[model samples]
Target chain A: MPEKTVTDERLLELLASEFTFEQGFALLVSAYKQRLYWHIRRIVITHEDADDALQNTFVKVYKGIAHFEGKSKLFTWMYRIATNEALSLVQQRSKHAAGTLDGNNSAALLKADPWFEGNETQLLLLNAIAGLPEKQRLVFNLRYYDEMPYEEISELLGTSVGALKASFHHAAKKIEQSIRAI
Target chain B: MSKNTGQELEELSPLLRQMREKGDGLEVPHDYFDDFDKNLKQRLTERGVRRHALRQIPVAVKRRIWPGLLVIAASLALVLGAVRHFNTGNEPAELAVLELSADDITAYITENAADFEPEQLAVLEETPDAGNQSPAPEAGKATPEKEEIPVEAVEEIIDEMTDEELAELF
Candidate 1:
């Protein structure tokens, strides 16, 4: 049988009830895990790191969901968590690779990733995006890849729409320049 | 925030439009998403066990643990006092515990069975002779007598408890 769609309101209700919490959590994971995985994958640049960040994101959500007062959309709240986890993983990885010979080379990491099916040009674009500053990289991914609205992006990132637009513009320009140089 | 009209990309950078056409080119292992929640369930369960293990003693159990120890301590003190009163010579107090028969000890415990309590019974049920049993609380149900410990205080205790301390707690 086809499953009935669970709305965010219904999800929150299910989560609030102790008896139905696991059921609601399952539905929540089924709903957002793929979307979140791709979003995290874009930032962390590898399946392994993305998986780690995604798991941590869900764990955080489980711990903090009770405090979520429904001030923002549930998707936005979860996206914020996924973004933070992805960035934290990147930071930790960079710290680990600081003095290593291989270093935290995203391009090399992407090429080595068994699941990355990109051609040379696609690889170059990903590499270019990876090279952008953290804020610019995040802005570009949410805008260019996910096609998330500027308003939603702003809400998730706690940045102004104008600043996000500007960051996206600079990110796109830098990525284009990087790809052109190669 | 405005809708992500495609026009923004063209005005921002033509190269980005072309790159989008090339796609992100990411893939997952076969059935990755299908198994993701199952794997996540396992992780969550493991986490639940760890957190539950940390809160091994409920507030009721905390209040009760000391009473069991006191009963044992008081019984030993009374036994020593009786031994000292009877044996004027320095025969040593250790011989009193040694002198008692298995039946005598069993009868004493049977007489005082009311003092053993459910929490101590739970510990004995879990470990017969191992002397170390899990101190996991009674299925996490709070009775009226449960004195709720603040979560911060529980966290503080969790941080300070070593393996030996945790074992002894059970």
Candidate 2:
């Protein structure tokens, strides 16, 4: 089912005014920071990278809140921002590393990462999932890991539901085949 | 996560279902979230101070400049009005003209003929015995040109001066 609308009118009103802006913004960050952090962490695949992206996202949200027209849920709008920031960080890092965020590199990083609690099997699955193409990888993670609904993913990614489903399906099949070969 | 039931995941792919059963391996440090808002608050406060400082600059500049600008504008208006008031009537020029004897006027016209219109020359020609050159009887000794006018030309020219024209001369 689609997520219920989460726009709080009082929060928006407080954000719109200069006097109550910080209070509203604090509440906003408290509510969404954990979710945003995990989502960015999934894309950027590092605690540090995710933290950077999350902070930048909140700064942007703070600056842009007055202009928000409430056409989409606040969570969806923020998710889109977080997604872009995380993807941008990935692209930047890939450029520096000569596009070496492949399955082997991701697996190595995951193994070294102290925050990652997964064993060998989980690491192998994550490596296979990371090996998928960028769009498929994002679709797969958001659907498989985050369990975001198709409707909400459609809103966040601006992709048709059918296209997202196809991407996710292909991604899952590829990961399965990669893991089976291993 | 609530929407994805065990049966649902199994239908999608058994491998994904197995992976789903094992939680995603990511974790944060203990009590990481406890300090997140506090750290973010510090960063935001710094940023907010910077933004507030930026927003104050133009307003401060306007405040500092406006009073001086208004004074300059008023000074310019006053100077322009004084110039206009002084220039409105050529009082000094009219007074100099009135004080001249008719003979001086005729002589000045003759000497600076290129400066006057032909109509002024015609008016000069109509002066009775304008050719006559005699000083006024009551006037003290005048310049050589003043000697050229008879007393009648001086009286006639004086009589032609309207009251408003005389007032303007004063």
| Fnat of all models, as shown | 0.44, 0.31
Chain B TM-score of every predicted model: 0.27, 0.26
User: Relative to the true structure, how large is the alpha-carbon lDDT of every model?
Assistant: 0.71, 0.72
The TM-scores of all predictions, comma-separated, are 0.62, 0.61
* Runs off by more than 4 Å, candidate 2: A1-7, B1-7, B46-170
How does model 1 score on DockQ? 0.16
Q: Using DockQ as the measure, which candidate wins?
A: 1
Candidate 2, A1-182: lDDT as tens digits: 22223335445645656777777777778778888888888777778778889888888887777556666777888888998998898888889878757797787778777889988888888788778877788888888877888778888888998898778777777888888897
Docking quality band of candidate 2, CAPRI definitions: incorrect
* lDDT (Cα, 0-100) at B155 in candidate 1: 38
RMSD of each: 24.2, 18.3
lDDT, candidate 1, A101-179, per-residue tens: 1213877898889989989888888888877777788888888877888888889888998998889887788778877
For candidate 1, what's the RMSD?
Answer: 24.2
